[model samples]
Target: MIAIKGVSTITVAGLFAEVGDLSNYRDPRQIIKLAGLNLQMNQSGYFKGQTTITKRGRRRLRSLLYQVARPLSIHNEGFKELHHYYKNRANNPLTGKQSYVALSRKLIKIFFVIGTRNCSFDETRMLRDIPQLKPLQEVA
Candidate 1:
C-alpha cells in the first residue's frame, strides 16, 4: 500500500488492522464491499432512486480510505489523473465529494492488487484506458 503515492506506513498499518488480511479475500470487490464502497440503489421499475455507496461495512475502513483519497488526489500521479477523469468524464460527471468516494474505492483495489501480486504501483497502467488521459507516446 505504501507503494502507492500519498500512502504511508501508518496508513497501511491502519488499513490492515481494519481489514485483517488481504489473502482472505478472493477478489478486490470483496474488499470494496467490506469498506462499504460498493454502489447500491433502490429500484422497483417504476421508481429508480439515485445510486450511492452501500456504506454497510467497517466504518473505520471506509473512513480511512476516504481520508487517504484526498492526499492521493493531490500527490499520486495516477490517482490525481484518475480523479480528474472521474470529475470531467463526458457521461454522468461526479461532483467533488462523489469523486473522492470513487477514488477511495479505487485505492482499495490498488491495495488489493499490490498485496496479492507483490508489485509496485504503476502510474501508466492506471491511466491507459482513457484515450484522452493516456500518456503520449515517445517518438521512435
Candidate 2:
C-alpha cells in the first residue's frame, strides 16, 4: 500500500512485493524513527537548545540500522562521499542528528530499492543517484 503511493516505479514496487514482509516492520517511517532517525527536542528553563532526537525509538532497530550506516560510510564510495559532504559543511554544521537524518533518508530510499528492485545494495549506484552531494573541498 505505502509502496504504491511512494515515488518508486512499478518495477521497483513489483520487486518489493516479491520480497514480502521484512520482519514485522509494517511502517517504514516508524522503522526509521525507531532507528533514532527522527527529529527531537530539548528545553531548559530559559534557554532552549536545538531540537534533538530522544533516542527513545527502538533500541535494537536503531542500532542495527546505524551499524549499517557506519560501515557503508566507510566502504561505500557514495556513503563516504555523503559523510565527507556532511562533515565539511562550514556555515551550517551537521550535528550527529543531522548526519543520521541524511543517512536515514538515504536508507529509506535504499530499503525501497532493495525491497522492490530485487537488487542488492550498491554503493556506487547510490552515489550516482545522489550527485548533489559534493565532496568537502575545505574545512572551516
Candidate 3:
C-alpha cells in the first residue's frame, strides 16, 4: 500500500491504505461492479420487473464506502452538494441503495485523485471539477 502523506482524515487514509494499489484495478467500472453497483434485471417475456444490484462482490468494501459517505454528506460541503445533486437532479431519483452506489463510485474517484497527487481532500476543488454539483450558499 502506498502511503499518502498529508491526508487530513486518518480514517479515510486508512481505508485507502487497505485499498492497496488502485492502479492495479485500471477500470473504475470494474470496481463499481465489484462493489455490487451494477444493476441486474429479472424479466419474463413481456413482463420485466425492476432492476437491482447483483450483490455478488466485495460486500466489505461497499459497506465501508457507504459508512464513509454518511458523515461526509453531513460535514463535507462537496459531498452535501453531491448528495443533493444525485437526489434532486437524477431522472430517476436514487433510493438509498442507488445513492450508496453513486457515492461509492465518487469515493473511488476521489481516492484515486488523492493517491495520485499525494494531497488532502479539497472540497472546493472537487466542486469545481464536478460542475454538475453546485455548492450551496450559506444562509446569513
Candidate 4:
C-alpha cells in the first residue's frame, strides 16, 4: 500500500484496522461489499431505478477508501489511466464520481491481492485485466 504513490503508511494501517484480516474474505468482492463500494440496483416492481452504491457497510472504510481514491487518481499512473478509461469508455461511461468509487473498489481488490499473496504492488498486474489497458512489451 505504501508503494502506491498516494498511499501512506497511516492510510494502509487504517484500512487494515477497519477491514480486519483480509484472509477472512474468500473473494475480494466480499471486501468491496463490506466497504459498501459495491453497486446496488434501486428497483422495485417493473420500475427500473438507478444503480448506486449500497452504502450498507462500514462507513469508515467507505470514507477511508474514498479519501485514498482522490490522490490515487491524481498521482498513480495506473489508477489515472483507469479513471480516464472509466469516464471515456465508448459504452456506458461513468461520471467522475462513479469513476472514483470504482477506483476505491479497485484499491480494495488490490489490497486484498497483495495482503494475501504477500507481494509488492505491480502496476502491470493492476491493469492487466482491462483489455484496453494492457501493458505493451518490448520487441526483442
Taken over the whole model, the C-alpha lDDT of each candidate is 0.86, 0.58, 0.66, 0.88
- Per-model clash counts, in order, read 0, 5, 0, 0
After superposition, the stretches of candidate 1 with alpha carbons farther than 4 Å from their true spots are 135-140
2 against 4, candidate with superior lDDT: 4
TM-score for each prediction?
0.91, 0.59, 0.70, 0.93
Q: Mind giving the per-residue lDDT tens digits that candidate 1 earns over 22-114?
A: 999999999998889899997888999999998899999999888999999999877887898899989989999899998888788888889
Report the number of the highest-TM-score candidate: 4
Candidate 4 lDDT tens digits, 11-30: 99999999998889999999
Check candidate 2 and list the clashing pairs.
15-116, 16-115, 16-116, 35-62, 40-52
Query: 36-118, model 2: which lDDT tens digit per residue?
Result: 66776677798788877667656655554555566656665666677777767675768664675677557766774565456
Task: Using lDDT as the measure, name the better of candidate 1 and candidate 3.
Answer: 1
TM-score: model 4 vs. ground truth: 0.93
